[model samples]
Structures are given as C-alpha cells and as structure tokens.
Target: MAHVRRDKKKLLTRIRRIAGQVAALERAMETEADCSDVLIQIAATKGAMHALMMEVLAGHLSEHVVAGKTERGRAEEARTIMELLAKYAR
Candidate 1:
C-alpha cells in the first residue's frame, strides 16, 4: 500500500527484529535449550509479529478504509479487515 511506503524503514526494522527472534528460537531448538527458554522465545516472537501486524492493520484502516472516497469502497475494505481479523486474531 502507498501508506506503507511512508513507514517502510520502520516496518523493515520490525521485520528484521522478528527474523532475529525466529533465528534465536531456531538456535535454541538446535542446542536443546530448556523448554522454558524455548517457550519464552516463542512467545516473544509471536508478540512481535502480532505488534507488527497491528501496526500495518491500523495503517490500512486509516489510509484505505477510513480515507476511502466512497461508502462502498470503505465498506468493502472494512469487510476485508474483519475477515482478516477473524482468520488471524488470537
């Protein structure tokens, strides 16, 4: 989305951090780290991913749905957002 372009760097940084968390989780598994440690890493990674998703979702709502030029367009985007939330939300 065009709005993403405005915050591309910030989003990339969040993605990179999430990637690092995943790599750490992989390493923990490879080394047979304690289960608690592995679980903690998993939680951290999931939370980071959720936060990133929320940030982008907010942007989409603001820039695409709320700012849509037509009522129909807004309604369509809102429905898509609801579907995504239903599919992905914890």
Candidate 2:
C-alpha cells in the first residue's frame, strides 16, 4: 500500500478507472488486437496506478511523517518518506 491513504472518493475513482482499463485489456486480448495496442493500454493502466500511488504516498507523509513527527524526530521521518517518494517517482 506504499503508505499513502487517500480520501475515499479519490481512491474509488482511481480504482474504477483501473478496473475499466483491466477490462479493456482483457477485451483487446480476446479480440486479438495488435500487440502495440495492448501494450499501450497496459502502459496507460500503469500510469494511472502510479498517479494513485503518488496521491496516497503524499497523504501518508502528511498524516504520519509530518503531523506525527516530534521536534527531535522531524528530520528522520520526513527524510525517509522523501527518499521513498523519490525512489518511487523514478
């Protein structure tokens, strides 16, 4: 779950789109579409999933790494999450 928890509405919307993308991929396979077309859809789905992940990660950082930090521990958790987010973005 990559630590970010988004609002219900945003989560649901992203999930719905991912589900539709999955269905589309399946249908494309069933219809024997071009390999390129199927791959393109797969990439689109991946991009959507990544966007959702970023949203959730941001939320997690806000609530946990920032709000939960102490004066002495502030740098530690914030740095950890920033590193993780950078890695994920890459």
Candidate 3:
C-alpha cells in the first residue's frame, strides 16, 4: 500500500471532485433539469470513476500482480482484476 500512499493526494482529489459531481447530479434531479443534461453529467461521473479505477489497477499491476510469485497469488490477482472489469464493463 506504500505505492498507494504516493498517489493518495491525487486520488483523493479525484474522489472529492467526483463527490461534488454526484451532489450536483442529485441537485439537478431535484430541480428537474433537462434529461439530456443529467445524462451528460452521469457520463462525466462514470468517466471520472473509470479514470480512478485505472489508476488503482495500474498501481496493483506494478506493485503486486506482476511480481506475485505463487500460482495462487497470481490467480487471486487475476480474479480481482477480472471481477472489477466485469462489474464495470456491464
């Protein structure tokens, strides 16, 4: 997780921005903004999330996945990556 610590500040910044976007999206819904506009906001939020996911995945690949020695460890790493991909690839 030391690698994670290196990017912690940048990651938190992205997370906070995403939070703000979500709040704005909620407010837009409450105010009954145009449907198209809301959908655009949703797309932006999803994109931001994907960027964050990639950063995490990159860190994992470099710090653990590639260097994992045991078959079980590699399998676990692959499973984790696949699960996230499947969930997000919907």
Candidate 4:
C-alpha cells in the first residue's frame, strides 16, 4: 500500500468495482437468485478485493520492504506484509 496516496484514483476505481459487485450480490440475494449464481458473484467480489490487495502489496514490497534505507524499517514492512498475507490467505 506504499503508493496509495499517489495512486488514489486507481485504487478508487478498483474499490468502486468491488462496491458494484457487492450491490449486485445483494440484489441477487434479495431476488432469491440461484445459489450457484450468488456464489459466483461472491467469488467475483472476493477476486476484486484480492486484486486490489495484490496491487498495494506489490508497491509496498518494492518501495518499503525491499528498498527501505534502514534494516529495521524493511523488517517491519516485511512483517506487516506477512501478516496481511496470512490474513488474506484465509
């Protein structure tokens, strides 16, 4: 997430798409759409969120974890990223 401020618009676009997917999922649930269809929508939303996370993670890895000036800063960034990955994998 290192470049979030610089890439605000891009991140917002990704978030907006995820929001639209969530809305669609809600509509599907309200309409009693097929279980499989709802599952598909859910998967799409999850994918969108995962994609956004990956984008931010890449920036953080390059700009902070790998390129940080101090070893302590880099180690901290790496720890943060590992925690995020652990959560995301679940």
Number of the top-ranking candidate, with TM-score as the measure: 1
The C-alpha lDDT values of all candidates are: 0.96, 0.81, 0.89, 0.92
Residue-level error in angstroms, candidate 4, position 64:
0.7
Could you tell me the TM-score of candidate 3? 0.86
Work out candidate 1's RMSD over C-alphas: 0.8
Q: State every prediction's TM-score relative to the real structure.
A: 0.97, 0.72, 0.86, 0.93
Backbone clashes (count) for model 3: 0
* Per-model root-mean-square deviation over C-alphas: 0.8, 3.6, 1.6, 1.2
> Residue 70 in model 1: shift from native, Å?
0.3
In candidate 4, residue 47 scores what lDDT? 92
lDDT by residue (1-89, candidate 3, tens digit) is 66789999999999999999999899999999999999999999999988998998889887777888887888898898889889988
Per-residue lDDT of candidate 2, residues 45-69 (tens digit): 9999898888877777677667774
Better of 2 and 4 by lDDT: 4
lDDT winner among the candidates?
Answer: 1
Candidate 1 minimal-lDDT segment of 10 residues: 81-90
Candidate 4 lDDT, 1-90, residue by residue in tens: 448898999999999999999999999999999999999999999999989988888888989987899999999989988898898788
- Angstrom error at residue 48, model 3: 0.5
Clashing pairs in 2: 4-56
Clashes of 2: 1
